[model samples]
Target: MAEIKTLAATVRSGTGKGAARSVRREGNIPGVIYGGGEAPTPITLNYREINKLIYAGHFLTTIFELDIDGKKERAIPRDYQLDVVRDTPMHVDFLRLKAGSRIKVAVPVHFLNQDVAPGIKRGGTVNIVLHAVDMLVPADNIPEAITIDLSTLDFNDTVHIKSIELAPNCTPVDKSNFTIVTIAPPPGGAAEAKRAPGKLCSAQAAESRHMLSS
Candidate 1:
């Protein structure tokens, strides 16, 4: 399950570009909370604190509890904008989530047991086509990351969406068949190496037969 985090924020009564700039000038980030059938609320959070979360990664899918004016709201960072020059957060949008609410989120993929994989042992490369997959998950059951075991992978093998182990309650957003990872043979050609001994033996037997016939 995805871990929940608490963020400190305050109510921002003012709105518009000028108001947002003013908030930023004061070392805070301007943002809004929408959805959950409640009127959208404008708010602000400490620039330094929110910056840490943004830089830490997975801000979009990570569940968060916004403590606004002493009132707590369960939400997630739906969208955010950054200052290209400074690479700092400019604006953010929060989406409220309730218990049992299902949302589509991209979960990170982590491969395991690579050392024992036949493809890796044979000097092949594991090409990861999808680093993340969008999954429909319950609000309280969001996964922090998805796992894929590569021990069964062989040379030229491909792992598709059907092979992934997902929760019974979770469903993938992608309807089409997609590849998660694939194994490619080495530059010298491992397949050729495997057939070299057989080919040589067959050729030697053929040469001996010709010699005897002659």
Candidate 2:
């Protein structure tokens, strides 16, 4: 489960671009909280504090306990907008969370035992098909990542979604079994590329997508 952090915010007096600009001038980021059967609440957060959180990674998936003028609410980040040129945060949106609520998130994938894989030792390339898998999980029970063991894999071996063991109660958003990664045969074999042999080609990626649709 992702860590829950406490952030302090103050209620904003009004809405619109003018109001947002005013908040920025005051060294704060404008934000809003909605959902969980409540009206949207406009707020502002310290620019520097929010900036660090955004760059620290996992800002979207990490739950937060927001302190709004002394009132607190539990929520997860739904979206955030950043400046195109400056890359500074412009606005953020939070979705209120209710007990037992399940939300869809893209959990990162991790591979294990790559050094000992027979295919890798034989010069096979590791072709990653999916960097992350979207899953529906309990608001408080989200796993940090999905781990796949590659120790037993050999050349031309493929890992599929159905072969993975997901955390309890975590369900993949996609129902069909799909390839996650493949151990591509070394150079001089079929489907060769100038890049690493295991590096995925467009054709392999297209085939995976086809499996999802089929």
Candidate 3:
């Protein structure tokens, strides 16, 4: 397990949109830490420090040791506000965590052995129905990502949640039978060939019209 540590911040008094905008102009991100039976603590974090962590995709489940004015705290990212136009972070919300408590988080899923899957060799396409899964895990035992092996999957086969083997202390939130990935014939391979160029077949035409109607 890799431990991520970040410098703590001391917050001065500020309020409203104007103060937040000014903080951003100075290369700082306005944020707050809340949860765990304590009042929300307003704080500000360095923009550069946060950008690096966000860029590495480490905010989802990783714990950070935040050292604020010689005081230490543990936290996990809860929510983030973004500047939609510039695609930059505007603010962040961190939830203080306590040991032995289960936290709900979304964990990234990595597909392995895709190039060697039997379905891919047979002209099938892999469709990822779910890129990540919601799991309830102990805060200290969160996994970086869940890896799924697709080496033996055949066409029309699916990998479901129940089939996944999770690491210790990690449990998926969804029902056991949830489908995650499926191998299917490439779209419009044979169907497209059957339809006349500029005209759709009865089934295809009806489906298209229905889609437009909806």
Candidate 4:
């Protein structure tokens, strides 16, 4: 479930480029809240407050309780603009979330038990195809991340999306099964890159030829 973080914003009295600039000069990020059966609201938040959340990561997926003049609304960050030069947040757009609403979000995938994987202990490489999966999750039950177990995976074993276990009311948006991760054999596995009969480097190849000649 997504943690609801509380934030404060104030309704903007004026609207325009100059007004927005004034808001920023006052150390606040200008923004709006639309959707969820209500009229759009133009607002502003403290720069320090928004910057803290923006840099902490996962701001988009997490739900927020926006308090505007004592009225609280459930919201999710829909979009944001950043300063081209300073990389600071310039503006924001939040979408109101309603009860039982299913929202599509990209959830990060976490692989577990790499040390226990039989293939990994043998020097096999764990390749991740999809680091995150897009899914439709009940807004109230947004998961922090989806976990995949690799404890039993062996060399050359593939992980498909369909094999993954999802939380209740959460399902992948991708209709077809797709590759997520794989445990592959190490490079140059039991085979010579240049020669078929023996695995040899250039110097070793020369040594073999000299031995045959001798």
Q: Number of the top candidate by lDDT?
A: 2
**lDDT tens digits by residue: candidate 3, 1-214:** 4255675776636867888888899999988888888888778789988877787775767788777667688888888887889778899888887888888989888999989987787678889999889998887677888889999997778998878888788888876688989988667563443445698668888999999999
Candidate 3, 20: how far from true, in Å? 2.3
Against the hidden true structure, what lDDT does model 3 obtain? 0.81
lDDT of each: 0.89, 0.90, 0.81, 0.88
Candidate 2 structure lDDT: 0.90
Model 4, runs deviating above 4 Å: 190-214
lDDT of 1 by residue, 1-214 (tens): 8889999899998999999999999999999999888999999999998899999999998898999999999998889999999999999999899887898889898999988998888788889999999989898788888899999888889988887778768888987788999888888787654554445566788998999999
Runs of candidate 3 exceeding 4 Å displacement:
1-3, 187-214
Of 2 and 3, the candidate ranking higher by lDDT: 2
lDDT by residue (1-214, candidate 2, tens digit) is: 7788999999998999999999999889999999988899999999999999999998888889999999989988989999999999999999888888898988889999988988887778899999999999898777888999999998889999999999999999999999999998887663342357567678988999999999
- TM, every model: 0.88, 0.84, 0.81, 0.86
Model 1 ranges with Cα > 4 A deviation: 192-214
TM-score of 1: 0.88
Candidate with the larger lDDT of 1 and 4: 1
